[model samples]
Structure formats: C-alpha cells, structure tokens
Target: MNMSSNMLSGPKDTTRTILVIDDDSNFLNPLKMSLEEEGYNVITAENPKSGWESMEKHEPDILLVDWELPEMKGTQFIKLLRENKDHNARYVIMVTGHSTTDYIVQGLDAGADDYLIKPFAIQELMARIRVGIRIRELEKKIKEEIKKLTVLEMALSVADKIGNPISAAKLHLQLLMEQETVKKSPELVESLTSLFSMLEEALELISKYQKIKEPHSVPAPGGKTMIAPE
Candidate 1:
C-alpha cells in the first residue's frame, strides 16, 4: 500500500480534508487531483492498511473508499472504521463497480453514509461530497447545541438545590436582626449586615442562572463546565 497527499497551495473554500482509499493508482490519482481542485485537502491510500493509518493521523472529515481493497473488502474496512469511536463520526462514501441492490445495502449496513457506482461522473461525485460535508457540519452543530443544553440543565439544577436554603437563611437573619438584642450590639449588627450582603449576592448569582434563556459555557478544569457570565 502507498500513501500520498495533495496539500492545497493557495487559499481555498474550506480546509475540509478528504481521504481516498483505492488500490488502483490510475483511478486514485485523478480523483485526488479532482478533489484538490475542488478546494479540499486530499489524501490517497492505495490499500486499507495505509488508509487506516492516514485516518488515524489526519482524521479527515470525509472518506472515499473503494469497494475492493488489497488487504480487505471495502465493506469490512468501513465496519472497522465505524467500530472505532475516534473515526466513526466521519462521512464515508463507498465507491465501487458493484451496482447491485444487495451490494449497496451491504455497504450502507457496514456504516457507509453514501455509495457511488464505478465509472460515475465526476460532477455527481462532487455533488455527493458536498452533501456529505453539509451533513457533517450539521451533526457537529447539533452536538454542540446538546452540550450547551446539558450545561444549562445542570446549572438550573444546582440553582434549584441552593436557592431555597439561601432564602430561608436570609429570612431568619432578617428576623434576628429585628430583635432587641441584635439591635443593641452595634459590632454584631455590622457583622450580621455583611453576612446578609454576601447571602444576597449569592442569591443574585443564582437568579442569573435561573433566568438563563441561552447558556454559554466553557469546559473548566477537572471535567467541569463553567457558565460564562452575561
């Protein structure tokens, strides 16, 4: 198996990377050039072994895999890629000479996002690639939105747990400050006033979290989410 890469020379539409795995050099080289011309970073691997290595190294967003590889069948290669968590999220398009319905079903069942019969038009292939790119982008965006919502849910839960106790404490402190004994000692009164102020600030922070319509957060140390202040 051989590996080659075509790095974009100048500014391009996007830095989306594509990996092509096919043992036929004649087919692989032209496909690499066509993809590069379409403003994609293209990596070519002549067999599944080199393809897997390239996948590990580059983590390309889209993959163009031939149905038959030197080391293993294309469907088997796709299965292996799908089983690995790191590479499973990629958009895989299986390219093969097989046009039978069963073959297409097998490829899709093996985790291919799309399939193209051999001798396909370059324009059709490009169109398919564009669709794959859009799908990948949408999936990424949805995952980020879910993460944000999860963080917001956690924040609201924390606020709910702490809000009641803080409110009760403030109420008791207010009642105690109104008593004759508490009013008589000026130093103690000052300390209690400061404590009340601190409690009020905590309540205000919790209120902010409770009223959050959209939560923005960052990953903090120790695998925690820290909500960004408005």
Candidate 2:
C-alpha cells in the first residue's frame, strides 16, 4: 500500500480548502495541481486513514473522496464524517468510476453532498464546488437567524414574567412616597424619589419591550449593530 500526503497552497486571496483522498498517485497529483491553480488550498491523502487525520488537523471546507480507498470505501469514510458532528457540516463530493444509479444513491445516502464520476471535466467540478460553497453559506446564515429568533423568544418570555412585578413595584413606591412620614424627612424623601424614578423607568422599558412587534437593527459601539424593537 502506497501512502502519501501533500499540501499545496493556492492564491493568498482564496480561503477555501479542499481535501482530496485517492490512492492513485497519477490521478491525485494532477487533480491537486488543478485545484490549486483554480485558487484553492489543496490537501491530498493517498488513503482513507491519512485523509481522516488531515481532516481532523485542517478541517477543510470541502472533501473530494474517491470511492475505492485502501482502508475503507469512500461512502464509509463520508458516513463516518457525517456521524461526527464536528465534520458533518463540511461538504463532501464522492468521485467514482461507476455511474450506476445504485452507486449514486448509495453515495448520497452515505452523506455525500455531491457525486462526480471519474474522468470528469475540471470545469464541471469547479462549478459543483461553487454551488457547494453557496449552499453552505446559505445554510450557515439560516442557522444564525434561527439562533437569533430563539434568543429573542427567550427575551420576550423573560420580559413577560418581569413586567407585572416592575409595574407593581412602581405603584407601591408611589404610594410610599405619598406617606406623611416619608414626606417629612428630606433625606428619606430624596431616596424614595430616586427609587420610584428607577422603578418607573424599568416599567416603561418593559412596556416597550413587550410591545415589540418587529426587530430592527441599530448601530452600536465599535461599528457593530444590535437588534432593537421597531
């Protein structure tokens, strides 16, 4: 068994990394050079074991795996990666000489994001890579939006629970401030006045928060943006 590994750097502006796992040196060498020429960081591993090690170390954005590997089939390797949460999100493209429907279905079922038959055009492969990148980016954005919505829902729940208490506290403070004993002592009057004002502000803010029908973005410090009630 011939095992080999190589890492080739592409253009500095390109940040996408692609890992190619194939035992055929003749096929792997040119493919690595082609991918690098197309402005992608390329890592080549001749066997599945080395490929898995490289995946753990580099966490490449895309995987180009040959179907027949030395230690395990490409589908099995893809399945293994899918089972591990850390690598599951990475896009996988299975390369195989077989074009049978069964093989294609098997690879897809094993968690390959795409399948490329052997002897494919580099242009087609590059196009597939572009589509994969776009889909991955869209998925990431969707996940971020979902997380933001979840946080917003939790915030609304907390605001609901605390709203009545804040209003009650403000009302009680108002009643206490109206008492003769508090009004007689200047120091007590001043302290109670400040406390009442704070409670009033809290109630007002909670009222605004609970009435939020939509979220709007507001500029924050350091050129950042924060979500606010619209």
Candidate 3:
C-alpha cells in the first residue's frame, strides 16, 4: 500500500537514514512511499550523479539503488562510493531487474552489499533493510566503545608517566618537613606543605579520571551527533 508523502510529525529520528537512487518514478516513488511508511528517513535521487550529491549531503546509513542508470551503472557507482575517504559505513543494496547469477556476482564484487531483483516483495525488502540497520547500529556502538577505551588508555599512560615524579617530589617535601633545619623556618615549611598538598590533589584527580570507563559525550566538530573522546 502506498502512503501519503506528508511526513509524520514527531520528534526527529536518532536512527538510520536511507538514500534511494533510481531514475524511474514508477519504481522510486512507490519505494519511497513504502519505506517511509515503515518509518525510515528516505531521500531519493533521480540518477547516479545526483545520488553522489545526496551522498555528500546526507552520508546516509543505508543506500538503496537501482542497477541501470543514465551516466553510470550501479556497479560503477558502488565502486566510487567505496573509494570515498570520508564515506560512512553504509549498507549498499542494489535493486535491479537483472537477476542473473553473473549480475549478482558483479555487483557484490564491486562492493554492493546485497541485491534485490525487480518486482521484489516489499516484505523481503524491509527484512533486508532491517538487517542492514542492525549491522549499522552494532558497528556504531562498537566504534563508540573503542573510542572510550582509547581515551582511558591514554589517561592511564599519562598518569603512569607522571605519577612516579610526583611521588618522589612529595617524599622529598615530607623529608624536608621532618628536618630540624627546615622545620625551624616556619614560612618555608608552610610553603613546602602547600606544594605537597597540591601534588596529592593531582594524584587524586588522576585516580578519578582513570576510574572513568564510561564514554564522555562531546559535540563532534560539525556533525549532528556526539562523539566520545579518542
């Protein structure tokens, strides 16, 4: 069943986005309606060239494309997308009338993740999309966890490198505090004690930072989502 194009009014999705690249309105329009009805954020392009433009604009999590296009075939488009340096870990699925084993091999070898033949069942298509969404979410979560781990590793390294020196300095200050010569000068002893207290605070702060394994959310340079420290 086709759905109304008017998007549902609600809080914006913090979920997956899909970009569909196909020149055929008969195919593209209905596919757009079906996916959107299923609550996906769908963006469409008429051809492969404009599809690249949309890719640059959205960096969608999932890409749905038709095989036969005007300027470039689906194979060429997938190859180009894989080569992009700033590319997302997008799931690319080719929807084509070509159903031969040879065509499927060609698409997959060129970096298309999955393929669907024309007149495909909408239910099956949704199933494939759900699989792609699951993979995307898992990868994103793993990446975030890795970033947090890396930050903690760095913090630990910094603490290890600086810790010995602070410990040694504190010991020397304590020795000075105990000396009769040093204890005779009240002002000098007080200064030494203050410095000793600061070193203790530094060690405490490092202990607290080391204990934090949870990821810290910070605004990405310009991206919409938050990024954990690396």
Question: Model 2's lDDT to the true fold?
Answer: 0.83
Better of 2 and 3 by TM-score: 2
Question: Roughly what TM-score does model 3 have, to 2 decimal places?
Answer: 0.81
lDDT of 3 at 188: 94
How many collisions between residues are there in candidate 1? 0
List the candidates' TM-scores in order.
0.86, 0.87, 0.81
RMSD of 2: 5.2
With a 3 Å backbone cut-off (N, CA, C), the pairs that clash in candidate 3 are none
Error of 3 at 188 (Å): 2.8
Q: List candidate 1 segments past 4 Å from native.
A: 1-12, 216-230
Q: Write the per-residue lDDT of candidate 1 for residues 100-140, one digit (tens) a residue.
A: 99999999999999999988777677778888988999999
lDDT of candidate 3 over 1-230, digit per residue (tens): 32443443433344668999999998888888777777778999988888999988988888998889989898899988888867736799998999899999999898988998887777777778877877888998998788767866787788888988988988988888999999899999889889999999987876666666675766667674442333
lDDT of 3 at 116: 87
